[model samples]
Target: MERPRRGWEIPGDHVVCMYKIIVTPNASVRGVASKVIRYASIGEKEARQKQEYERFNAEIISWYETSKRVGLVMISYPPEMFDAKYGGIASLLSVIAGWNVSMNEILRVKLLDVFLPEKITKEFEGPRWSPDKIRRKLRTGGEQNCFLRVPIYPRLAYPEDYEHRIKCLLKKAPEIAPDIIADSELLFNHEFCSIDKRIDIMSKFNKHVESMMDAKERVETKTGCKTLFFINVSGKPSYTLEKTEAVKEAGLDGITLNVLTTGFSLLEDLRSKFKNLIIYARANAHALLTRGNSVGISFDVLAKLFKIAGADIIYTGAPCGSLDRVKPLDDHVADIRHRNTIVRNPIYNIEPALPSISGGVHLGNLQVNILLAGVPLQITVGDGIYNFPWARNNLDRIADVIRLFKKAIYIITQRKENMWDDHEFRELRHKKCRTYFMEEGKCVDPTDKEIKDVLRRWVYPEFRDVLEKWERGK
Candidate 1:
């Protein structure tokens, strides 16, 4: 048997990186990664912490079966999926999903004013989902999206509060591994970066980071389960490579990385160097858009392009996790992970994709998210895991979420029997966002030329000088 090895690399103009996803027998233990990870009792605690996760699991299953509710569906396009909150247009959705209001009783609004891509608009050509369509889609699983988000802000506790809070954060990894580890500050403007530069937070920050890293090590050491861990280096790119190395050193099984946080040259350099890190291009490409929703590359196109550029994975979106873009989300994920058909065997691994089902993931939505993903999915969770009320700590909830999530991933990955009847299964798979084909021709997939333009025309040319300096160690 070949021992699986993972690495990253850049092939000339293309940033090419590859890593394997293992489905090992011992992989199910929540924190005990006895094989791929080993670290000191870096942070003291027996491998027994995973036992507490039993509590984490129970609370979550209870929530899902009980209080979870349907939230509103916001509809507004925003550039940069990783940046600021999408349009303030989420009131309806917030009221619905956050508040759990039913859609049928709500009033519907028809509009005459409009702005949309010509190609896309032509398909709908002046159509919006009538309430009936929306209801049908929702009921039929044709369209429904939800999200659970955890924004990894810097340790916000006051200097006095830091120790205990940090300890709490570190100690609970097993009980509360989240769906989406923002692994980064969800929102940081240029001003914050400048502030980081002026202050000496770098060293102190690492100490905090190390504590979390140590916690991760303990979890992997004990439970052996590897849930998605989004490590956002965008917070500090200079430290990113090293931090990523630390993550691997700590024995983390997977990570989420953002291409926007660092220059292409830096990413190229990372690909060439570590090769072990599984890079997930974060956010919408920063170079590509503005308030004008027109003229933008689709996340699907970007994922494929980045894969070609050496990214091994991409977070496409949840079933419209935050805003209800299920139809489109479904299409994007399918387009990315068509998997190995008997005939294709290996279909170029085009986007080298992981349609990371992310967005607002929470306790209430776990099973629904499982159903939405249809199997073989990476369910990224965040707030749902961290924000648990202490008596009912969120960590246990996270454990349960992962258990359910992995159950889905495992079954799908194994080609298990479809538990849903054909009619129900087809209905779930037939999400509406994927139906954008007005022209009778099979739509052509994205071309790498557009990616090249973004790279060469927008980012690389400016990035060359710094890269050269870094390469030469000047």
Candidate 2:
């Protein structure tokens, strides 16, 4: 009769949102119990009564201190606090990232993970094109046939330069065809080379590549697969929408979005607008949000969010690449595995996103990447392909590098031989040539002793033949 005490009113059958957060207690705060405070609106008497009716109040599900300063807590909130359907990702972050008034006492907060209920997970139309569907469409058969992606880089000042590169790459498409060719994130719309001009050039080459593949299909079973060309479409909402419309009209394969730069909501809107176009989410600026230990969200958590936002391919940094310089070997590997697992694992009705291992992948380290990330993955090489000494002087050699990359993947995945014990393989392994990228220290030459060592090892006997034939320019 008191009008439910203004803001303290409780509704029947209210859904609860669950979250796992890591918090660093302020110097004044004492004990773990002090870290787990309930929402101010939820009175003890009302909470107890709601529990009896199968409805729950905002409360700490679990809590434990990992260190003197840091503590891990699992908390639940009433529907009044957050609603996935109406709130979306922004509101979800506001709650877990400690923007709530109840979290004012905490010094530092890091969102480790979130366990959303089915009702919530279903609201997000996860990835429209699952990794398996992508593979099938690309004609990439078998688990061993990993998807390869290369980028157009070094900054094209003019549209003609961009067209020239595409022509060169497509001319050698039959020799070593890659699954995807994307524009760099830095390569955005400009007066000198606008998105429309780039899309026009790519659309023209797309037809040529398709024809080349069609001709090769007569002899090679999987050789005729259509290569997806993804243009960088990250910009202002209106501009991005405009560029995407052009890409769709041009019938281009896909478009890339810098998720961290453009925001998750943009990715979701694009997926909703374009049902079939592949969305490659690039989190190049993730380190600013995920590099800290006691602050910011974890990479795994961000990766899951990207998947939920309908990213068909998410860039999970490669363990053997530049990520090793920033993150520990173990952490990098764990991040890669976690991203790979969540995208493919069944969750409500969400489709799986393809985990991309990029950031310095080359033929030298290609085998280690395949070993680390496993099957149904995308390996993207930018500097690895474009910076190759041979390819720098001659565009034809770009196809040769791709051929070597394909052979390396095949040998790693299909061959059953134990090359680790062979003397030449062991020497090559010791040189770290099979792990480090070109820019990390030294550039790997086809004539390098380490490469010759791999050949001499004859570990995957068939690889030796491929290398010899490639050397002969056959």
Q: Model 1, which residues run further than 4 Å from truth? A: 1-182, 185-230, 235-256, 284-294, 323-351, 387-474
| Runs off by more than 4 Å, candidate 2 | 1-56, 78-81, 101-104, 141-144, 214-224, 415-474
Whole-model lDDT, candidate 1?
0.33
- Estimate every model's Cα lDDT from 0 to 1: 0.33, 0.65
Instruction: State the lDDT of candidate 2 residue by residue for 175-256, as single tens digits.
Output: 4577788887888888888888889888988888767767767234333256789999999999998999999999888999
What is the Cα-based TM-score of model 2?
0.79
lDDT of 2: 0.65
Clashing pairs in 2: none
Task: Please name the candidate that would achieve the greatest lDDT relative to the true structure.
Answer: 2
lDDT digits (tens) for residues 1-474 of candidate 1: 332221122122211111111122333221221211111111123323655422111100000111112111112221221111222212211221221111222221111111122221111111121223222321212222221223343423233332333233334443333323334434332443432221223234434544665665633322122223434455466666666665566544234556655554445455556554556556545334311222222343334334434454445554424632434443433432332111111123222234455566643344334443443344555444454332134432434434433333332223332222224323322442124222222121112342222222222232344223322421
